[model samples]
Target: MELALVLPIFAIVLFALVEFTLLFYARADVVEASRIGARLATMPGITQQNVEAEVKKILPPQLGQGAVIKTEMGKHSGDVVMVAVSIPMTLASPNLLWPVGYNLKGQNLYSETRMIKE
Candidate 1:
């Protein structure tokens, strides 16, 4: 009887742990992608489209599918180039749990980086 009572709770906790771990990993990937994009943006003769492509390549397929990338070019020395990436993340369905009314759907993660022109 006790096993039945605690089983659902244990399952939900396990699901939450895994989901949160994946979420944090995804966030880190986004941060790294933005930094790389910004660094590439700082180089001479690198176009905005190239920066966007590099950022997309760094991200996983899921995140890259709906990623929004913004790049700003720096024309003069010491000017700052900016790269911003926005990725909308979809959490596991509440149905996967015991239906405790938790809605983590449609969470968006954003990262921005700026670097001076060389």
Candidate 2:
């Protein structure tokens, strides 16, 4: 009886751990994508739309859909260029025993990077 009671709890913990790990990995990818976008934004004559498009191309398809990219550029050369990326991810897997979704449905992971315009 004790074994049966403990097994489900253990399995839930294990699944939760795996799900959190994947969430962190996705967050890291978003950070990298933002950095890539910021680097592109530093290029001369690059539009905000172009930078966002390039960032989307670098991200995985699932992440690309919910991804939002924002860019800010200063008026002068050597000015700061900032790029931010946000991705919404669902932490709870339907296959898991407990569907403990975050913030009702999912959480948004955000990343921002800045560089000087060249």
Candidate 3:
């Protein structure tokens, strides 16, 4: 097996692994942010803007940037507050021999947390 032929494949695999890890981190951050936001919602006289700020503070820098943060206050009969965070995944390069694509639109990280308001 020629090292030249195998090196590119190895590189692609490594890139894919790194990309997946980043996505995982983003997802965790979003979930944590949602949970934090929901907790804030349970506070008395807590404004939506304050909750939004808390969510942004809890999220990672990459997840916070260009990310959509949504909140549903008393959307359910139980007065459960719902928070959702989403962000699109972008690839570093597209020339690799893998499924990596620049601006992969469908790739999104999201989280939902529900809590009763106090």
Candidate 4:
């Protein structure tokens, strides 16, 4: 009887673990995408749209669709580029014990690099 009572709690914890793992993977993808975009943005003659396209291509299929990217040019007289990437993660269902659903937000990944214009 005690085992039966504990089984559901164990199952929910397991599900949450799986969700966290997925979120970590998505974070890695975001970092990779930001790096690629920053690199491309620094390249001479690379249009903003082209850089965005390259960055999108680097992300995983599911992430590419939902990913949001914002790029900013350096204000000073140097080649400093900034890229911010955000991805949303929605839970499959509400926790068996919680109200409606517990939404865990994905972290925003950002990368900044300075390069010599070629």
Q: Candidate 4 residues 54-83, lDDT tens each?
A: 878998776777777788754444567777
Cα TM-score per model: 0.87, 0.85, 0.80, 0.75
Tens digit per residue, CA lDDT, model 1, 39-78: 9999988999999999999998878988899888999878
- Flag regions of model 3 displaced more than 4 Å: 75-78, 91-103
Which stretches of model 4 miss by more than 4 angstroms?
74-77, 91-101, 105-118
lDDT of 4 at 92: 21
Best by lDDT: 1
lDDT of each: 0.84, 0.80, 0.72, 0.66
Global fold similarity of model 1 (TM-score): 0.87
Ranking of models by TM-score:
1, 2, 3, 4
- lDDT order of candidates, top first: 1, 2, 3, 4
Model 3 lDDT per residue over 18-90, tens place? 7667667767777888898888887777778898888888876656776688887773345878788777665
For candidate 4, the TM-score is: 0.75
Error at 25, model 4, angstroms: 0.5
The collision pairs in model 2 are: none
Could you give me the TM-score of model 2 versus the true structure?
0.85
Give a tens-digit lDDT track for model 2, residues 14-79. Answer: 887776777778888898999999998898998888898999998888889878788897667899
Q: Count clashing residue pairs per candidate.
A: 0, 0, 0, 0
